[model samples]
Target: MAMSDVLDEGPFFHGTIADLRVGDFLAPGYRSNYRPEVVMNHIYFTALVDGAGLAAEIAAELAGGDAIPRVYAVEPTGPFENDPNVTDKKFPGNPTRSYRSSAPLKIVGEVKDWTRLTPEALEMWRERLATLQSDRRAEIIN
Candidate 1:
């Protein structure tokens, strides 16, 4: 299938239900409740412009892997954080923001902080770290 078509299906909404792993897309707390635009915001801010690597990760995440865990998909959204992809949705814990990172497949992940981790910013960093980890894991999976 075409890459765009898979992305349209959604990171969690792939053609095959088995292609999606029900993992935590966000961290917990204020960050846990971020809109998809927020994640996308970081993507642009972090300059995550590589689609080749991301696409592969989505396929792996959809396959349900614990070792190399990560969500993968081409961020179809241009440069608009408010655009809201598909992953931008209120999860169970955090319900204050939207979701982003709409892919044909994704990996479930736990949230954790980076070096400067605080109670307030823990969720933020956690999701960030997890996304990075997910990205790396996606690489391995691919």
Candidate 2:
């Protein structure tokens, strides 16, 4: 489906380990958080705050540093499409509310009150990601 056809009004969020302030623009061309070997062509965001939180946590863990996970309220400066990585690939539709854009995402504010995963849940996710990373068929549709 074309990106313009999908209608969603979002108070969107982007999750990461990078510390950013309001008015910052998150652009594409960075290393993939799930597969660091690949440079991403699109900047990803979600309408779901907790999904972004999970992404942030995973990114922080993968980076293996003292950095804390952060989620920021964002606005896409241009058109976006459903994230093919998850949409229809894993779920039938966009239950994840995830999207990607080649254009920059402007940060409106930092989201400080999102729920955090517990240690056990975090570990489970780590294991799952590790397995996905190791599987040869689990390619990112970059």
Local distance difference test scores for all models = 0.28, 0.92
lDDT tens readout by residue for model 2, 29-135: 99998888889999999999999999999999998869799999999999899999998999988889999999999999999999999999999989998998898
Candidate of highest TM-score? 2
* C-alpha TM-scores of all predictions: 0.17, 0.96
Could you give the C-alpha RMSD of every candidate to the true structure, in order shown? 15.4, 1.0
Show the lowest summed lDDT stretch of 10 residues, model 1: 28-37
TM-score of model number 2: 0.96
User: How many backbone clashes can be found in candidate 1?
Assistant: 16
